[model samples]
Target: MRPNHSPEYVQSDNSLDVAPPYFFPNVDVQGFVIEADLKAVQKYCDDFLNLGTREERGFEYRAVPAWPFAQLLFLHYPVMISAAPDVVKGGNGRDSENPIPSSNPDFIVPMADRGTTSQNEVFAAIPVMRYGVGPKGLLVESELEWILPFIVVDQPWSCVCGREMLGLGKMMSRIDIGPGYLPGSFLGEVHMPGWDGNSPEMQHDLPFLYVQTGPALPTFRATEPLKSLATAFQAKPVRWALEKIAGLSNFVDDASLGLVPTTMQTVALKQYRDAVDPECAVYQALVGCRSKYSEISNLDFYDERDIWVMFNYVGSFREAVDVILGDELKKPLVVYPELDKTVSITGRMAKVVGAFKFSANVDFDDMRVLHEFDIRKDRKEGGHGQVLKRGSSDLTARWFRPLKGFFGPRPMP
Candidate 1:
């Protein structure tokens, strides 16, 4: 239940003297300095800040199409940490209704995550996507959230037959990439708000699309919008979560080579479909892009189809983009979010809940309150805070901060 964080992790290069009297006149999280390891975040910020110039979109990460999205998996990041056990123990066998984390490669802590202010809810991840150019800057989409769900096993290997991890029902969906953004959009958008107008990284760019589960969307569309069948199943993991991950690990090796034949299920799907039509394929080839199928296939499922169609559709759709790109429809540049190595440094890789940069501009009240403007519309332990969107002109803006910039569209069910 304790936070899996350390003082060294807190030592950030961006660490302002929030330690007291000398902090910014109206700085947010005043007095409390960011982790001293602010350099990771600072570098991440700087890279994007210099987005869209000769070195970026024009040349691509390494002069490759999908490289931007996949290449940045080498940066150091300080992410939020959480345990997969907490997610499983938080509810029934299939009730993976946990709030989405703000970042990836984060640590999930049970009791220590409480936050009286938005800034207190910091998470971690190496921002892998490059900001690209778009209509205004980068074409920011709606909200789409993603979450990885699983139940670990003590010793059972996931690749075994009939293992929940190896079968069809062992996965969950968290975020969905939308239609507009290409693979390199993240870096493209960096220049939108006049983002480093003359940075070397800037060039024509492509952006990846995804739905945001910004904690504000009315409903989640990534899955089959949980059924209204009014049926409650047992809470035990008939199929363990970790078992499935092990199974999936064997399927694909590189994220860019597309998904590999890992489990009997995915393997079977490929086989069966191929058998049915030696040429025409139903399950499209997995794009080297980092879609969630790799993550979803590892969850323990209650209702199998919900997760199935979600990933199936997402992968298929992204494949279509490849087809478009092949037609010489190549945008000036494209970017997909990549995970920097700020991970590996953490204990056991964990879920990211939040991450921020520059400084959070929260307003304190006369009573030194985080905010006097709004209340947590619905406070459910382990559930989620009613998060506001990036540009929601509503009252929720003051209640939450848009650290992720509300990119892509909201996820579909």
Candidate 2:
């Protein structure tokens, strides 16, 4: 790879010859050269090719060849600096309560009229540089400079630079959180040109690592049911509520489904705990379900069906109760109720109601999961094959394994 170099600035009439803010390359080229073996290189290429093409929400795209390697590098290395809490602190000066405030008016730069200075303000910043193959098997680098600060005030979840960084001008597209390489984690995906520029016919749906604690606020809001679930079960209550409501008949066993047996209380409690408790088998199954969805989205496109299904299941439960009892079952019902009015004071029903309410307010498009990506263990274990000896001269000529087969099925000449 070419050694990291600072940008040269041209003298201007009003401003001194100042270099534009450039994102520094974060990958250790010499380390990659020494550590990467043929098997590892081949696996990286295969993973990229396996992504193939994807179509979602009427948009078609593919994964760039360098995407896998880049993802691995960013996740495993300390390339990204987590945004300080103060950097994204809300206007009220609270750390996690409010949305990040816009930059000061004096610091705002005027560009093409976006109609608001908030859109022009900078909030949280992440500098990224991509590595790929060049002509003559040389490693080339490209900087995502314009896409630095991910603004929060005007457009909460969108990158301020948007498609301008891709040289595609302004587009309706916005960057969003998607399934990550690991379960219970998320990554950022956007539609852009491939690294090689080979696929002019189709855009690449590239995925990259982002700082989890960045300026962007979560799109999904936790509802009462979700809160109750977390409080009662310390797990995803919305998912649990949906499952319980979907299989209401199995638990209640009533033709009208209005009456529930008080004796089944132990069974119901076990079922809920089994599904939500991290130590239980059903909890692993839930995690597996999330992992499977992530795998599917990586191969195809991000699908909202799974999320919608959870919400739909909850709605169906609500409808069933309303039809059978002629009254709304405001909470999720997992077991039969006791006739004793004193039992109602135990707050079990409140938890159920919260879960049901959470389902109704669930925003399928706003879901995200956390993935912990750290390779310190691998380094400690000395799993990085053979690394080259470090020296000043050796660092200058850093090399990276050529990523072949990036462009899928090149047309025959």
Encode model 2's per-residue lDDT on 72-139: one tens digit a residue: 11111112121112211122332354333244422211121112211211121111222223432223
Which lDDT value does model 1 have at 290? 18
Residue 108 accuracy (lDDT) in model 2: 18
For model 2, state the Cα shift of residue 241 in Å: 23
TM-scores of the candidates in the order shown: 0.17, 0.16
Q: Determine which window of 10 residues in candidate 2 has minimal summed lDDT.
A: 284-293
lDDT of 1 at 207: 21
The candidate maximizing TM-score is: 1
Alpha carbon lDDT of each predicted model = 0.21, 0.21
N/CA/C clash count, model 2: 6
lDDT of 1 by residue, 78-151 (tens): 22121123322223322256464434324233222321111111111122232223432223311111111111
